[model samples]
Target: MANHDQVLDASGLNCPLPILRAKKALSAMESGKILRIIATDPGSVKDFDSFAKQTGNPLLESGEEGGKFFFLIQKA
Candidate 1:
């Protein structure tokens, strides 16, 4: 996995909140930077996948640990 430049905690947030915060975080970052996001929403699997696809950002890694979802996304 790439070294993340920022971390966004979306844990306990549902649906678009995670994706929305991620978008805001990425907006403030330089292109090609990586953001690590921690979310509790099970729907985040599909949400992050679609978010990356729609935004053209590369989803580097994503998995669950301790009932939480972890995602590494490189800003487009």
Candidate 2:
């Protein structure tokens, strides 16, 4: 896993919530910094993918482990 500047654990949260939190977290981050998001919602995979595309933030890496989904989003 890549070293992240910050982490937002959105575990147990559903769609929109995780994405919303991620957006907010990224807002406070500096450009080129990485924010690691941990979410349980399976929908987050798609959501984050779209988010990275729309926001121009690169999705550095994404995968699942121990039943939880993880995303590394870098601020644009």
Candidate 3:
């Protein structure tokens, strides 16, 4: 929740969309900037985790709140 550099609300979006949108958002950010992603798809938890590892980005924090899955990804 700390002043994210960008916010991507992928709620109600399925599989690849959430990850794809996240990638686009992260691509637009400077290194070390954070992208706050709010997704409804449960697959995003694992998808984003793998994405961070594969892309060399960092998953700072991830959790759920009020039926929404949230991820804080830092561009690296």
- What number of clashing residue pairs does each candidate have, in the order they appear? 0, 0, 0
Residue 43's lDDT within candidate 1 is 93
Top candidate (TM-score): 2
Selected candidate, larger lDDT, 1 vs 3: 3
Which order, best to worst by lDDT?
A: 2, 3, 1
- Pairwise lDDT winner, candidates 1 and 2: 2
- Over 4 Å off, model 1: none
Report residue 15 deviation for candidate 1 (angstroms): 1.2
How displaced is residue 26 in candidate 1, in Å?
0.4
Q: What order do you get sorting by TM-score, best first?
A: 2, 3, 1
lDDT of 3 at 28: 86
Question: Which pairs in model 2 have colliding backbones?
Answer: none
Instruction: Assess the local accuracy of residue 50 in candidate 1 as a C-alpha lDDT between 0 and 100.
Output: 94
User: Model 3: per-residue lDDT, tens digit, 1-76?
Assistant: 5668889999999989999999998888999999999999999999999999999999999999998999999999
Winner on lDDT (2 vs 3): 2
The true-structure Cα RMSD of candidate 1 reads 1.0
lDDT, candidate 2, 1-76, per-residue tens: 8999999999999989999999999999899999999999988999999999999999999999798999999999
Cα deviation in Å at residue 15, candidate 2?
1.2
Which of the two, 2 or 3, has more TM-score? 2
Q: Ten residues in a row with the worst lDDT in model 3?
A: 1-10
TM-score of candidate 2 versus the correct structure, residues matched by position: 0.97
